[model samples]
Target chain A: MHFPISDVTINPIYLICLGFFVGILGGFFGVGGSFLAGPALFAFGVPMNFVVGTDLIHIVGKSIVAARKHWTLGNIDLRLALIMVAGTIAGIQVGVSGIEALKKINRVDWVVGLIAIVVYTSISFFVAWEGWRTSKLPALKSKGKTEDQSAVSKDKMAFRKFTRWIQRIPLHPRVSLPHSGIKSISVWAILGVSFIGGAFSSFLGGGAGYIRMPCMVYLLGIPTHIAVGTDLFEIVVSASVGSFQHALHGNVDILIALIMQTGAAIGAQIGATLTQYFTGPRIRLAFAPLPLLGAGLIIYGLITGHHTR
Target chain B: MSRSRDIKSFLIDLAVYGVLVVAYFILVLQFFGGWLTDLFHNHRLGYAIVAIMLMVTQAAGLEVIAHFVLKLVRPKKP
Candidate 1:
């Protein structure tokens, strides 16, 4: 039961090196850090709770770097970022509360595991489906299009309807922003997503970007680049708030986080720089499996009675 | 734009190290020693789990501190 530093301590140099690699992958794909870091740490004998908390911090750092990089590229959609933050915060609150409730029944892990599995798998399906659908389209194939434009058009009609449903409600000052070309938003949708994100983040210790980003990009029809940039902005606020909350409750381990962050800080920069060389699909192809594999690892660990103790 | 980014990046990196070092020291004083010992005395699995978790928490704080510092750090090279 005694986890002396000697028992579980990984070489700081190795962790830093790993952090650098994760950072590069994160910058290239815009994820992979949280999704992979948690499981990787778990395998290394880290607890689940700490993994979540630290992952959030890692995300906060990476997002800051990523957002700034994107801003320089003229890729950020400020209006969307603002609205998403509104929803993202609300969602985190609900997520935290839900975990509190679930813990009472001693079923929090199961609930979190279920959500993780569902969200990760759904993402895998969507991305894989997109890849498949694109390959099947004749015009796109012949055009030598690196991407299937059809996916956008086909999804557009559905996304517009969804957005309209979201926009029908009145919850704001009717603020107009040129970035989104709208005077209003479905505050309800934003709130709904925020609530979902909050609960998922609190219980699972990671934001449901699998859900949030897709909702922003496909459901709300925000551009993908903006979605990445804005998501980072929202994470900076929400994850920090969440981390602070956990810290107040004495759930955060400051030392390990510090060391991890040291590496992450350097990693974030490397990631941001690498983003310039990689195309979106190439990045996705290279990095998409990390979370899926992480999810698999967790499930395997659980099913094999890794947590029975 | 690229040159500015590269310059800003180095500044961010420097700031990250500064913040993370400070945060980790605070954590070491607050919980690292006691928590590790408690895990040793009680349930080993629990202790290991906690240790892992704590490491993760430390990592998170480190990441945030790095981010904040990076933001404040000027792009002097640019």
Candidate 2:
């Protein structure tokens, strides 16, 4: 299809297929799918600005599809998600303004890319190691272990001591999220974590779910399934804000987003349904490689200065 | 009989989404072609508001459609 806004003549089939593949991953992981889609769009000759903007547009739509499916399965923690939004919005403003300042200094490209590569690589390896360790535990072999409950319990013990220590801080106005099974967590703690996620999202120009999902499970002690659903819910709101901002800046190609979303909607449904068949640890294990892939892509971009925009 | 009903429901759901998507596209094009340009020229904030409203409407509408389809196609438990 010839998308005039980006002035790119690409096959619609390829875009649809890309959307389908990313949609499945996004639905399963609660991400914006930009780590995969952004590079592919750049490779297809779309400008970097348009790639980010258009990806946000598709992400908003795709997230809605995925989140709805997850909601049907009772996976979303609406209370937590709503609370996080306040911090996320504030963080996004800070990140965006910081980037604008960096741009004025003419160091936004390589500096940002290098930091992204380092951060993505470190986090990816850590998540992968944790997933690998969990997968090897004897608890994984427990009989008829639906939802990997035994494995999850064992994993909880490892992080439980740390969480307990953090929970002891005399922070006021602690909130309890029953859906996520979190008994009590200070509102400040939730906002602090959400702010960092939102900052990474705006700075890296990606959905930030890669960071937030793991944090929800590991730090906030939310279950993996609920984290995925809540992440998607967060993505829907953040991506909507991002797409609108990008559109105002004349960066989005609405036609491309519209076409890609058609495939993404279908693929998201399939991916969300497929999650019902997998255990929580198994899902985490599968997610471990995606960030590594993103890290590798950023490194490649840094080295080649290809698609640096 | 159940299988046929499920298929019929799926088709109807698909048709509904298709209609909504088409309507959404028309609305976007109409707004962009008419008032949106002027709004943008007058105030960037106005453009941002409209753009957000449009995007949110599209996303919400698509989510509703997707939820309906998923409900229709949910696997039957034995």
Candidate 3:
């Protein structure tokens, strides 16, 4: 019997092993493991579309696990989740269409590549900045850590000023969430971020968290754990929708998705469990290298014209 | 006393499952392509078929493991 290979289909065993390792990394770092998933699938001769589509599907399982774990830990801010999801879904849609439009003019790949680099660097810098601040000013750092979990900070004028600005916007009939202190946020902002998240999920198949999680934490004043949970929860929607859209275009490979998702699911469990061992910043720091490496690889792929095996 | 509430909760649960199922099928079809086209266009649907099998098996298998872990840690209500 002859085995079929794509431009770069490594052994199935390799894919499974990679999934396991990436799963651990994701769990340890609080990411969806798409950073690893995309490249692994690519190595297996999966087309860019399938790599992305399946990667999104793969993320769903892990996010479910992570979100549940966070919820149980009382780290989930339900209201903030809803708001970020709203933004992420909307942002992703616009991003997807924007990609499509760019494709017509034939520069989609480069545009996306550039955006990914920028997003990657920005997230890296944010994480690094936090580390820098902590090292420089222990007093200032300790206050921001989740360890200082007091009721919403009244003294943090910056937080209050930003949050007040959010409140002043006319967002009536704001959706309140269960067990969360956040009352509401602008639907427009939610839609905007969601659309961008959607586009990222659609195009790259797994970068939504990089965008949505941060937006929730910084712009929306959501706690880091909640942002992580909600971001994962929201990916289920974004990925599913994007996957369905891709399937309509006939790009999904259920069998491949199944295999990788299997390894990924087990990995997710381990990953979610691992979250208990590390603080948000520590986890972020630990996993920081993966995205930086991934970005470099993608740039190499682009320059080499080697998207596939 | 709470039949109405139970019904509403059930309905919501149903909606969530419905959405998940629909989303799953849609995703499967998108990345793998429709069965007919995949068969015709490439004449090599075998890889895709195997891939789907791998993903589904992994997901279901892990869920079982998770259930076991959950049960071991906190037994389900009888």
Candidate 4:
């Protein structure tokens, strides 16, 4: 297949299979799947710019499929998603401009790549460690048995208490999320977390869901399913904006995105539906290795300076 | 009877997914083929509008597909 926009000749079947594999992970974990797709596209000889833009274009479509499925399962927190969008928009502007400034300094490629490697590596280790700790705890009852099994455990109680303390910070406008069972949290705190997520996403050229999903659970005390749903919802909006911006810059390869999305659409639905059968800890545990895989790719890219253009 | 219902639901899911894939391809060809390029060449705002339209349509279309699939797969009353 020849992608006109990127002017790359590649196998369409490869992209479709990659999209299906990543779509399943993204749908289940609520990440943009770009962590996998971006490197794979680059390795397939797509330019770095095209990989980022085309991945975002596909992610917008894939997230919609996954998020809609999650919405039907009563997992989405619309209010949280909407609020996060505001912060993300602002953060993306700053991040993009920051990249442009770095470009003028003639070190945008290596700088951003190095930063991504460091951040992804650190976060992957943290997630893996936390997942390991969580898995060591006693197993919960099987799915569909009872809601009581979903309650916070002793080890998690301190983290929940910390979130409660932060939620009590006397901000002017506090909001309650009934769907996620969050009593009250400061609006500013939510924006702060989302802003960081968006900044990292735009700066690193991946969907911020990998960052945001963990924060929503560990920081804001949201349930795993809700975090996943809300993260996908936000990714749909953020990735769309990113795709538009990349299109304006002539970076998006629409043909590639379209081909990939054809597979992702179906895969996403399957992955989202499968999540209903797993417990929260199990899902988080399953998600831990994804970031590690992404970090390994970034580290490889940084070491080899491959596709650093 | 239950086996027959399960088979019917599985068939419905396959059919709906096929429909979704076909609809998505048609929409992509219609909007993205030359229409988007012409719009971008002529006017910047028009290009953005078309892009937004594409996003909105894709989102709505996927949601509709999901809704129909869910409805078809839902268990029937005894």
Candidate 5:
């Protein structure tokens, strides 16, 4: 109940329950559940620094469980995850610097919060529209479960033509990821997307999987299932680096992290397994509103001037 | 699997998980609490490594046990 590392006295049961709930979201959506967990922890009297840093370490643990499950289901593309790690770390630095710059200008909270709201809202609407449009595709609805199953298990995208165009860029150092069904995609594109993901991680807080996962699906042309798995793989590495840095700075409470992870372990397993029952687009559709929820929170904070995290 | 069978398997998994959780709290958290708290104050580098190590090991270890239990409870159909 008393976490001496952060010097916070909190209920262990609350931490466990929160971890379980967030773990489900992380496992199901391939996003760090920090959007919920961060605010909740702050409300429960965990220091903001510990909330952010401890959450990163917690993410690493949960993602490991979820990622392993996805791996067993043949969903991970290791090559893709490895490449993205490099860009992600670099982008985090840039994002951190951006935060400092905004702080100096005395507009850090408003500017950053507004930007996040716009980004989150746009992503929600875009994904919702895309998911809605694609759910109506003739190939999916015409027949019964067979046709629907294929479209669900695999990917069928409304933005296929644009994705194909992005894929056709003749960058010399192209990489082939046959597992993701991406043949000869420019390495630059992968780095660019991951770099943006990393930027969002540091800038917006959490793993920024909400942005990165969709980028993988729409821009890199990866299936939603693969993107979810691969994103978790990427999170395991990036969040480790982040948590370590936060630990060095005395922001992490390992005891708290460990306790939370116990509940997360179960939730992650259930979340990852449940993914197999849904289609790619349906996953995206379900994921759409999470960002909106985040946006609503930011808007609440902006109006009230009562920052949650 | 049928929905009912799936629910039955899930219920069994939850029971097994509940037991493991109690054991973990009694054996691991209770024992390590003092040492980990000492490490947090006196040895941050050690604490950081241990934090990551503990989280990863506990998570992976628990998942393995849970997965095994799940498999036993939900035997594959021929």
Candidate 6:
């Protein structure tokens, strides 16, 4: 399909299939799946600016259902999510402004692509190491349940101790998230984490869950389930804010996003359902290379100007 | 056996959803493509509004329809 809005000719089928693939991954990992979506679009010859903004619009759609489901499951921390939205919106605005500034200099593509390569590579290696480290722990294996919060207290994520330090920071006007098992945490801590997540969201697209979800759990000490649910919820708001801002700048291609989302809507259900059958750490280990795959494609695209034939 | 049954039902759900998605996108998005592109270039805010509304409707609306239709077919599921 020729998407005149973005001035690209792509097979709608390819977009749909990509959405399905990423949808399953998102559903499986309980995330917005932009880690793949943005890079994949860029590799498919979409510009970086469009990839960033278009993916956010798509995420807003996907997360609506997932977030609603989590809300019903009592997995959401509404207070935390709402507060994070405030910080997230601010960060998203700043991030989009950065993209706009880059757009003026005609350096958006290579610079953003380089940043994505570094970030994706780092994430790939870190997840690989963490998944390997976590899987070898016999105590967690014996628990026979994924995301056992108590067991995760001693989990060897290398940054598990940082959560304690973050939670201990003495800031005023603290709030408790009883749902996520957080007690008396500074609001600033929550905002600081969310602000970073939002910046990532606007810069790279999707919900930025790949960064935020882990932060919510490890940095804030929220239970895994609650973090997933709450972060997904916040993705909707942040992505919407991102979409509107990006749309104003003509960085979004709605035609492409809508076509892609049709496939994601169903694939997300399948992905979420399939998760019941998989062991947790193994899934994480397998997922370790996906970001690398995306980064590889972006590299190929950068070198040759397009990975597609 | 029940697990297999569940997977089978899920596959059926996907097939049905696939058909629905193909039909809907071809009918709606394809028809409005040029017009949306015009709005995108000439009136961006309108394009953005339509884009967001279209996304939300497809997401919230179609999912409900999918589930409702699936329930009617598989009345025993509740």
TM-score of each: 0.70, 0.75, 0.70, 0.78, 0.78, 0.92
List candidate 2 segments past 4 Å from native: A1-11, A28-31, A47-49, A69-79, A143-147, A176-184, A223-226, A246-251, A273-289, A296-309, B1-43, B63-78
Q: Candidate 4 on A101-198: residue-level lDDT in tens?
A: 66456555467656765776676677667666655554543443332243344434668777777778798699999998889999998898889877
Tell me the lDDT of candidate 5: 0.75
* lDDT ranking of the models: 6, 5, 4, 2, 1, 3
TM-score computed on alpha carbons, candidate 1 = 0.70
Q: Give lDDT tens digits, candidate 1, residues B8-65.
A: 6766675567456655655664666776556545545565355445444554555566
True contacts kept of each: 0.10, 0.29, 0.10, 0.22, 0.64, 0.72
Which portions of model 3 miss their true places by more than 4 Å?
A1-8, A39-46, A70-87, A98-108, A140-159, A171-173, A269-283, A307-309, B1-61, B69-78
4 against 6, candidate with superior lDDT: 6
Which residue pairs collide, candidate 4? Answer: none
Residue-wise C-alpha lDDT for candidate 3, range A1-309, written one tens digit per residue = 112222244564666566667777775665666765675555344555556656766765555555566667877665555565665565556645664565467664466666666666666676666544434444544676452232123234447676557645676655544454556666665555566667677777774677666555555566666666666666655565555554443445554555455455445445655565566444555656676666675566566553321
**Higher-lDDT candidate of 2 and 3:** 2
User: Which regions of candidate 1 fall more than 4 Å away from where they truly are?
Assistant: A1-14, A72-83, A104-106, A135-138, A141-150, A170-174, A269-283, A303-309, B1-78
* DockQ, ranked from best to worst: 6, 5, 4, 2, 1, 3
Docking class of 5: medium
lDDT of 4: 0.70
Q: Regarding TM-score, does 2 or 4 come out ahead? A: 4
A244-277: candidate 2 lDDT, tens digit per residue: 6666666566666766666565566556656655
Which lDDT values do the candidates have, in the order given? 0.60, 0.68, 0.56, 0.70, 0.75, 0.83
Model 6 C-alpha lDDT versus the unseen true structure: 0.83
DockQ of 5: 0.59
**Model 4 chain A poorest 10 in a row by lDDT:** A143-152
Q: What is the lDDT of residue B11 in candidate 1?
A: 62
What is candidate 6's TM-score for chain A?
0.92
Name the best candidate (by DockQ).
6
